[model samples]
Target chain A: MDQRPPDHITAAPSLAAKPPIVTLDGVSKAYANGTVALRDVNLSIGRAQFVSLLGPSGCGKSTLLRLIAGLGDLTGGRIDWPGSAKASDGTPKRDLGFVFQEPTLMPWANVFDNVYLPLKLGRLSRKQARPRIMDALAMVGLEKFERSYPRELSGGMKMRVSIARALITRPSVLLMDEPFAALDEITRFRLNDDLLRLWAGRDWTVIFVTHSVYESVYLSNRIVVMGARPGRITADLAIDAPYPRSEAFRMIPAYNEYCRMVSAELHATMGEASPE
Target chain B: MSTSAEPVAQRADRRLIALRIALPILVGVVFLGTWQILVTWLQVPKFVLPAPSLIATAFVDDFASLMGSLWFTLTVTVEAFILAVVGGVALAVLFSQSEIVATALFPYAVILQVTPVVSIAPLIIIWVGYDNVRVALLILAWIVAFFPVLSNTTLGLRSTDHNLRNLMQLYGASRWRILTEVQFPSALPYLLAGMKISGGLSLIGAVVAEFVAGSGASTGLAWRIIEAGNRLDIPRMFAALALLSVLGIAIFGVLSAFEYLMLRHWHESAVRREN
Candidate 1:
């Protein structure tokens, strides 16, 4: 093997450290109404894996994602990262990107401005961020819609703008909460394919929340099936599907079998009654 | 030709617009003809119910004096409306900054609005000591006319999109930037609607105040009505009343057109064709 470069080349240890993107130790969340949403969820996601929190409604899947996104604090556990200490004592490090179910685009902003919001928030000059914004919009296939307002776009197009906005930050971890549930079946399938394409290309981790068994099976490398009535993780399944998954894959028996299994698990999860 | 189909649709639309205009004029003619016939048959006194022809003749005879007072009333209305927009929008922005201050001063604004300017004009006349009290009376009318706009605009400012509001917060937008960019733009339709209502109200207020505050020179239409009544010039009084009604319709029409143009693309109220 060739020896490494000289001292100058090896100097100032790389600040590009690949720390664990998410570390939740015994994270429990109880709402103000005394309803425990999540109980002692111990999870670790690696740097660039696409993981899905698959569950029915009221399964604390969104709660878990919000915890990871630093949107809300855990009631009885700790979430830690390298820069967690310097974030003003209790303020979590604002690093994760989140996409909500409703596109939630600013109604007054055009597509380009919406995509540039986070970067502008990060104090980058508009000229400095313009190229990156355009590139992100192009990645979402909304390059021509840069001047169009949110109300003028279709539902699917608005969600694409949202995804573009999320990706413009180039964050390490992306959190989504049922982003495609409101979309039609066809648009949902298209977006699922596009998301997988983006996931395959970028060196970024994702934690997607969805109630759709088919969606969970299709986009994720690993699926965490959660049950309600105090919201616990019941099954964790690894999808051994290959990359660059196409619409043609859905017609295959293997894909059908996986969808059937996840659907059955989801049905079972929703059918579970509370324990006395 | 395809152009033939387009001109056919255009002709249909033009006919539709013409019918729209013709129908209203037809309705007005029918109403006046009925009124003239009924009153002539009923033999009503001329002082109580002058015929449309008599009123028209009186209007033509006294056209010069009537036009002068009409101009005076219009000038006061325009001046008062400008003052209200400037003062009201400023006060609204100031109140939006501090809730405690808004809550404290809002009752005073309500009192100022509801209290009749007619009763107050005499006192103002004594204080200002002249017919220049017309300006003060116009100011008083304008205050009432604009506060609803101030309050409505303030509410609209506070009722911004929550997620977008959060986005602004995360972006560290200053209070003024948020006000000008997000809050003000969102509140525009509401403010304009309030302005539409308030524009007519300001004109009414101007005439009403002029009735009480006019001295010798700048007598508005309201004062002319009073002068006609004192002289038993019943048809002339009706003519002044007609001019006032025309003034009101003109003010409201101008405001509605402005509202339509301003919000045509964005707001539902102003959008013409929806798919």
Candidate 2:
């Protein structure tokens, strides 16, 4: 396992003073077959922060996110959701929502039903969740297609339904694993814009995982660069760009500079490898 | 899949549906006409090859007896089919809920499937008692019909999307809720597919079992075929055979329609793409 400490690009003095919403201290995950997916990753995400776990393939970015979501067990160390309230299901994790890389909508379920899943599992009645489900659908611009099944929707629309499903419960922490990676650029950009709009002016923590530097830079305030071959964090840097970050933000030099920095850091992280 | 030319699409869809029904019927009429004309033109013997008209007449003459046999055969077929569905689905669910149970018993299920029911029909008939041939027939038919549903439903249950399972787990859904809401529904198309196969097999099983039991064992269509064959009443035999074919077609049609109804909304097999 790679034991080197993560090199912070800026040391993040701005975030150092604030209390973290989640703290990952030396969180390590090794499979039973002896493959180390992650190792000694320390991360403290502040409340409402948009953090991106960015890396090349096999970097365990996804594994880290899953560990944080309580979807998988860590073989070493621990994760703590500090000050989190116990969800109605009796887990502190219910205050969280997860969006997989795939849209992951139930193929048998229509739009309204797919969005209704999270709440439905919480034992909320369909009648009780109707308005909220509609609200979530409208937020994703799919109010007219409630009866449509996942097979009927375009890839982008399916992802929108997935997003709606994730947001229906209004969880404090939203974990998205490259949610827009499979979409076309036009769709991806539109979804990126939609996601940023939703994240704006709300106290929601979103830990997004992506291999795309531009995506990580555009969507997240802080990007944690990771390395493969016993996946470990290599660098952490803050975007520090102002919000309501518009398309015009993409055209600006500072945005390009941040992207270039992230790209270089990511490329460097990709360089050190014990070949498989 | 809906297009802006809604009326045109609707008309085309209607035409397609009409063609599906009409083409088969038109072919059947032409086939019968040719068969009748050739038989009459060639002076074929009545016993050698009866024309469609002679078969029709024989059908009319034996209507009461044929209907009684059909009803009996259908009862056994339907009863066996229902038992197979219940047994298969129940066994599959039990297997899915416990790995140890599945591991211990799945090989025996495979063994039952591989061993031909025809080979065992007489043995089963003897074992169940010659006096209770109907119970024997039911047992043989259920054995023949239940495996497909069992295997297919098990596969469907196992094939539940990993991501969906994780999503449900993340939501903290009860195991029962996950089984009913996700696994059961996911398994429906597979179960239905298996049932369609089983529907036909159950009929065959009932007939095969009755055939082995021989004359006086039951008043089923298979028995009528056997009885007619013994007397060289070829036309009556033809009539019984025709009825059996019709019954088979009807069973398939009903099961296909039911499958379409259950799956037309979401399953890929049932959904029609305009493109």
- The fnat scores of all predictions, in order, read 0.23, 0.67
Off by over 4 Å in 2: A1-9, A86-93, A272-276, B1-4
Cα displacement (angstroms), candidate 2, residue B158, comes to 1.5
Q: Write the per-residue lDDT of candidate 2 for residues A1-276, one digit (tens) a residue.
A: 332323333554476347888898999999999999998998888887899999989999999988888888889998887878876886675478899989988888899999998898888999999999999999999999999999999999999999999999998999999999999999999999999999999998899999998988888888889999989999888788889887999999878777777777777787743321
State how far residue A161 of model 2 sits from its true place (Å): 0.6
Identify the leading candidate in terms of lDDT: 2
User: In terms of TM-score, how similar is model 1 to the real structure?
Assistant: 0.80
Give TM-scores for every candidate, taking all chains together and pairing residue i with residue i: 0.80, 0.94
**Model 2, residue B115: what's the lDDT?**
98
lDDT of 1 at B73: 86
lDDT, candidate 1, B1-275, per-residue tens: 37768788778889999999999999999999988998898988889988888899999999999999899888888888877777777888888888898999988888888888788767866786674767676776686588768877877888877656654654446788778767787888778888887888788788777777666645888889988898888999999999999999998899898888877655767655533
Report the poorest 10 consecutive residues by lDDT, candidate 2 chain A: A1-10
Tens-digit lDDT string for candidate 2 (B67-98)? 99999999999999999999999999999999
